[model samples]
Target: MNTPNPDTPNRDPSDDDLDHTVRPHDPADASSAPQRRFDAEVIPLRPADDDAPVHKDEDARAADIDTSFEVQLDPEPGAGPEPVDDGIGYLLDDPDGDAYPVIPENLRTLGGVGEAIARHTRRFAHRIAFHAVRTPRYGVLALLWSVVGVWRLGNRQLAWWWVSEQDYLRSLAVASGDSREWYRLHREVKETRRVRGLILAGQAFGVLAALLVMVSVAPWWAWAAVAAVGVPWLAHLGRPEDHPIIVPAMTVPRFRLLNHDVVLRAYYAAGLGHPDKPNQQVTFETTMSRTKEGQGSQVKVVLPHGKGFDAAVNAKKELASGLDVAPSQVYLTHDPSSHRRHTLTVMDRDPLAIPAGKTPLLDCKPRNIWQPAPFGLDEHSRKVTLSLLWISILIGAQPRKGKTFAARLLALYAALDARVRISVVDGKNSPDWNKFAMVAYHFIRGTVPNRAGDPVRQLIDALAEIKRHIIDTNEFLSTLSPEECPEGKLTEELCRKYPKRLFIWMLVMEEFQNYFELPDQDDNKQVAELLSFILAVGPSSGVILLSSSQKPSGVGAGDVQRLFNRYRDNHAVRFALRCGNRNVSDAILGGDAYSEGFDASALPVGKPYLGVGYLYGATDHTPTVRTHLADHGDAEKILTAARQLRERAGTLTGYAAGQDTTTPDRDVLADVLAVFGSDPGLHWNELADRLAGQIGDRWADVTADAISAQCRDLGVPSVDVKRAGVTRKGCRKQAVQAAADTAAAS
Candidate 1:
């Protein structure tokens, strides 16, 4: 019924001819209806057997060169002048040697759950804004017409003035003379504005006219419209449908314009092209395949914020009807209000989405997704329980995944709890731990003892002392009186008066792998022994070991078995971040467990899964716990509190205390004096020999390194080692005899 306006010379893009060319659907079919989306027309599939070979190099791509020189070979013919075996191989091979398909550049995959949420939110906002405001198609036409009108008027005036100006004036004089001619000059402008205003006025008048017609014939039109609307509505209600209104809307385009506009906006923002064409629309819904149960299809749509809710619903119904999916499956939400701001409302088709007693996992409230069944708290209680019971947690993620933020949250949890004692050792010198320095009981920054000083050696030595303390404590407790048993004697009153075990002690090693690995089995075994001892008995002694690593390859699993003989029994937990290594998840959480549950690989930053060993009926259960690292205020409070407690104690206990608790037999002073009296460059072998009778060989390396590194860091020049021997100056006079002997020997 629409026609081009003669008054307007130019046509707006919206009024221009739409491309409706239909391509052959499926070649095999030779007869299928052509489908259109936005602007791109998709032909129906002909169902031809698509066994065609993909075009590629006939010869398989040449094999890649091995980086290792162990199997060097002569170069093949044309192998790039002997030194290179054809540069082509290097270009094709993956540098990391991973075989998985590379992520395509054009796909625009979401970075994480956070980015996913951000992405959907942005789309939602953009759609809402777009749907609320319409571009003026008529204004564009009006401007073009005005230009043509001016040109035509100018030509007419020019011709009249040249042909017979006086005669034309005479003719015009009969009807107001030159004034009439002058008025003609402004006629185009006046007429153009008049036409535009009429067009604008027509819209209101048309609405009023339509309403009047409806009222005048209300009895008749109402029945017919209801019949039309009801037919589609009943069909959709009766059967799963994608767009019941598709047939009706096609016939009633004018009435369905608002619905189409909203749908277009939603789909365009989502990158899901409008169903009518290929390009996306700001407000439209897209179709996903049906569920396994064949309940209905998964529908995604965005309803811009502040837009009429009814319009959005109508669009959703249209799309849902066409897809043959339930109306409830269609999601309607807001779009990104601006370029950066995003919003999303996802409706799900699964019945189990909202498990019993659990809150729906949605970014915004007022659940948009529909699940057949409702969930309760019982669905998530097991995980919630684990998070509360375990105080200090260690998290590891591949870079940029959210490990540090999660750690900070966990630290915050400890601070908020008030009873947990937490310490963090950031081995990588990352800036993450710097902000929480205040709340951490012990916040160690940079590599401990420096890279040159060898922090690994220092940590191993420290763990040795903690192990010794455990053994001694166990022995002492074993000999206690019946009334002095753990239940009666291991009280806070007893602990406050003593140095340790008043509260639970947790040592969080950010990258624990650094300490666990050693150059030789002996060193490795010693470190393992220390770790096993802690893991086995620390729980009883009020200590918990929480360590994090990128991968769990070199952690003390084998050692845990050998030493504790409790391989699976020890409660050492692990959490992997998007690891390709399936073995890790299987080893920690049982076989194929992560497959069904939350994928740790897909974990967003600031979120992590907690794996526990059969503690809360979790037979290798790995439950996700939101990691909340300690904030600045809480970190400060914890650190300040620890500092005050340590200040009152007036000493650094646990190995650094210099109490000689681990040494036996001879006085440790004799060994120090023996080293000091010798020549300046005493070789370690010779020093070990001198202290042989007093100190065992096992203790030699540990003791010498500990004493030497400590002294050098403290700036004490008591004993100096050189290539030749050892030297001593500013020696404590109390070691005179041993120093004189060393001086005489040198």
Candidate 2:
């Protein structure tokens, strides 16, 4: 057998080569010729190449053979070649490369145009109406001043000429030049003199023409028209280009013109823009109108990428500095319609510097109790109202910081509505709530001496009464059909339809923390539990609970603090005025509210800002509001007016109806005498029915057993008597008269 050279690429094969490539066949056993051929077929033997390159180096020849075989094994047909990895160049050419984002210009402006027109029209009408109604004396003085202005027109023109000539002469004196400058200055002076003469002549001719027209018109009203038109014309002529002749009475905020450059510069100053990177530009959508009162400019800004609304809000002080205004004058707010967009309002003046004046509650027309009541003005001088429909309120502040005042304002507003029934629980027992007692269905105070001589008992009793009221209200609401009370919430229609049953019920608990932090743990827990239930479910049934606290955190004993937190959470409307810390603000407004910029702790301390607080949950943004000032005299007047309104509407009920309690000072003995009034024998059942009829539906369940219990407590005697052919257990007129005499003597 011969062996073949494996490295040879072009060696011709002989029979020996073929025998070497094929497997050796064993013929000694000799199964058959067919078996021998089958063994030959089992081996695949390739023929040696006929024309292939030969190399002196065997290693090189073997490499060539391997390369030629690989070339012959081509890729699958129509399969494209693999992509080559070009180092770093592929990344440079990628279509999805990272770069600065481009902001598209906002071109939709027709809506803005309509809004501007509407705002200006409203402002104009308001100004006209205000001047017409409130300043008749000023208007007359202005008219007289206008007549004087016309008489001084010539003098004003002479004054203007003199000023102009002085300015020209000063410029000439400052000039440094040679002979050429002297000739130029002389020619300029000559031209200036000529112009001044022409202006004076024109003014004289205008006055003469006006006099001629006035003489020709010669009517009773023509003199008035001359004063009106001539005065303004002369005033315009005398006025400096930059200043108005007559100063406006109101302090108007002067806003700078808004442009792209100003907006970009503001962003840069606010640290929202990168100085090194010029591409990080604030994109302006469009410039909105100045505010209705001409206080500020509203600009829509699309912030740079990766920036959020909170960043813009936090940078409000810097933005104000950039705009050259006070921090309070600049308002930065997010535009909810777009994520990258925000609104920049730069005011010329601080709106809060000026007092918001008294609340507009008196000026407001009679409104539905479900609608929002005007509480005060916001930071923008826009009216801020609070909807009292289906919401409980939690107001917290440090002492003497307007917590009680704010609570009273809300209560007073509610009192104005004939359909609203008020209950005032004044733990402070100040005279602040004395007038409210005349209108409140339940007025509980420390001044009302109870058996224990403790105000906490009165507070607990008020809470219990409110809880009972809630149950009654819910039961009444449940009986109404869905069509009448949709969404199971109180509506104005419901109040009107069931005036006796569905009137608005408000419970104002002032210094509420005092009640919860009582020494008696049982009383504290009971009060907290009652408040939690009322806060949770009373709103939907036309029942509102407004509570004020000096300390809202850790207020009660044990789980009572947790109960207070629960109550605070349930209160949908919250106000915090001059809190000592952020924790108090958050406790009243909710956690993170202070961090989010609804911080009442930042309010100023003192009487001027007494009722000012941060109000949340009533509007899209938190607003600082100064509640109405209702002093003792104001309260009396309001109470008197409200009482009359309620009386006319026939909605007055409860304590306002002059009910007497079971105490010695205010026992029911006098009322019993008034009811019996020399009538010999009034049955217990008859007296109970009569008392129920007088006290309204809240006490409609008064029964003979209850009347007897009350009489026993008050030391009044009952006896069986015969009257009009009937005999039953009853009280004699003499017995009731004697009890009343005894109570009066005591």
Q: Which number leads on TM-score?
A: 2
lDDT winner among the candidates?
2
Candidate 1: tens digits of C-alpha lDDT, residues 415-478: 3333345556666668766644443445554445663345555455556655655566666666
**lDDT for every model?**
0.42, 0.69
Candidate 1 clashes: the total is 86
Give the runs in model 2 whose Cα sits over 4 Å from its true position.
Answer: 1-253, 256-263, 277-294, 336-340, 363-367, 446-453, 479-500, 592-596, 603-610, 626-628, 661-746
lDDT of 2: 0.69
Give the range where candidate 2 is weakest over 10 consecutive residues by summed lDDT.
69-78
Model 1 poorest ten-residue lDDT run: 61-70
TM-score of each model, in listed order = 0.37, 0.56
